[model samples]
Target: MGIDDRAPGRPRSREADAAILDAALELLIERGAVATSIEQVARRAGVTRATVYRRFPDKAQLLIATIEAAYGDPPPTQEIRDVEHLLTGWASILASPRLRRLLRRLYGAIEDFPEIARAYQRMLGQQRDQARRNVFERARDRGQFPPDTDSDVLLDLLTGAGWQHLAIQPDNCTVEDTERFLRAVLHQAGYRPDGYRQQLVPQGQQPARPGDKE
Candidate 1:
């Protein structure tokens, strides 16, 4: 039978599901994963505990669903105009206190819950791959990067190691550091600075010779 036929009493409401996820996110941000209880979410959402349990089996499932809702779906199409745009997006995500706290909790919880952690990791991998493909496609369309560039390698260099370090590091690293690293890597990979001229060279003129005075 169809979903509606199976539950003839009343179909599950999407609105209530969204409210539960919203409540879960707020509680998670305020009290963290360990302290946030299912009852607290139900109370916050003004729904019964039965409704919450009906949507999510347990706290872990709820947490996972909440995270997915917060991020929304991965972009259907990949596109990266430049390093600046990429860095800007990265900075925005990292700078958000709510997102940071949620990520930190996810990282810690992964150790205790391997299955959930693996699921998250799989989701992340898909996002990274999609992002990598988008970057190459955009760059090629703009003629800014060589068509032959290996997008996968570029993504690994830009995100793989550095992301792990940022996520696991004890001391917090500023977004500036990440931006600087990205710029250097892009320059090394043949990206030219668009707005700024190289220092030690005069604008609209070539560098002065050692024997010739300026």
Candidate 2:
């Protein structure tokens, strides 16, 4: 009936767990969180509702697990050095159809399910914190950022605002545009600018002539 009510002695199957999480993501994308029921997820996974319950205490828990699965574990390595790599990684994530759909669903569901919204907000905070630490550590190693730079503040200025804008803004900002804005902000904040100029130029836009420095 619930996560706490699982039978004693038997270990849960990792394969089954993966299958359920996969199904949950599919349903979340297809139907949005408001329409994605646990029963539907169970059917999609070819498992009983009881099994789904065994793994997750509630819909909120199921959603959390599904989100994590979609996002994957945080990068174990250091932060990206070049702005190109950083922007590329974010572009890849935002360009995913499934992730876009999930985000849309999450935005809609937040109104009706405040608790679920709060849980997701907390998860996003954790993700941002980890990312900031990794990025700052790499920046320090590369001598791009001062050793004493406040990673939390830098992350807030560069990333946290972008995330909030994506979640709240009515218009869909392109990944290139977002990255350009971040690059400018970071550059002004004293972070080294690598590959930022190339990234900011829009495709097919003619470069300024030799005397255009004015």
Candidate 3:
């Protein structure tokens, strides 16, 4: 039977969904993606294995859903403004130590369990990339970047900067600190949004420099 097949108008159990996702996240963090299984999650969540299987046919989808939950409510594609918006969102997510650990594990899984990565890409990657590309295209039109700037490479670099922050910075890194680092990266990349002044720098605050006291 399909996962969505239920009595007409019956509400899906939010409590059950929360338990299952929480259980799956704990397992993934503890054992990595390779060792986490629906059986294990079901036992931990105190639900039947069939319950998890109904919601997620396979492990990849379950893991992806867990990661998506970690992200909280994502902004609609239409609300993705320029690089500043992206940086703010990225910094907010990186500020969470729990999410940082989850992301680290997922990053490691890219090589060992490529299918999960592929599944995520198929589900969410293309849509997010297109939104970012639109941001870049608008920036180009506004003359913030050179017309020839390649959004793909720019996107890659920006993404790598976030990961580097995650991998390098201490778990206690502040959201303000993270945003400063992200803005510095965008500034370096010539991403100056049309502003009154300061070029992405906050009023009266100089751009953050490498090794500056945070």
Candidate 4:
């Protein structure tokens, strides 16, 4: 798409949609949620403001759409084939500098751009949480966690651990390290898959016992 070649009428092709979404994502990562506007995205996308608005309607929706596109497939909900699958997916995402920066921007927007937060919760949070809950329940069924274990609490714990790594320790984050950390948290929380030591613990390293220092 040329600088002046705006698609007329409604967006009719995947090219236009991809261009718009890609431009929006780039601007969001570069300028953040507050500074990025439909006009800027339209210009960057080589489409008109009307073209962008016809797809997104508003900035909140546009930003959320960009984020969801970045998340890719299988999404958090569909990626939960098992505990390992879930943790690995999260570790990969958290280890990404781009995604980490994007998340930080969104975190900042919670107070400044409340609409974005609301849109994110509605569009992504609920389904992701439910998928995680299902994973926890499956773990319980397999005796990784006790029958009485509370999936909600486990979910909160794991989610908090991930955010702490993403937000509080981005400079030191790595996929291997994040995976190990999440596995340690799960081990400490009474999660023990079959052959837990073989699968999770590194060679000759003692698994974290309950009540041990975090």
Lowest summed lDDT across 10 adjacent residues in model 2 is found at 192-201
Task: Find the 10 residues in a row with the least total lDDT in model 3.
Answer: 190-199
TM-score per candidate, in order? 0.58, 0.61, 0.82, 0.81
Please write out the lDDT profile of model 4 over residues 24-66, one tens digit for every residue: 8898888889999999998888888877877888999999888
Candidate 3 lDDT over 79-179, as tens digits, reads 68777777788898888898888888999899988999999888788888889988888887777765577888889888999899988999889889999
Per residue, candidate 1 scores C-alpha lDDT tens digits across 148-178 of 6677777777665445645764335567765
Evaluation by lDDT, superior candidate among 1 and 2: 2
C-alpha RMSD values across all candidates: 7.9, 8.5, 7.2, 6.3
What C-alpha lDDT values do all the predictions have? 0.66, 0.69, 0.82, 0.81
Candidate 1 colliding pairs: 78-134
Clashing pairs in model 3, backbone N/Cα/C closer than 3 A: none
Deviating ranges (above 4 Å) for candidate 4? 1-11, 73-79, 195-214
TM-score of 3: 0.82
Error of 3 at 7 (Å): 11
**Candidate 2 — which pairs collide?**
none
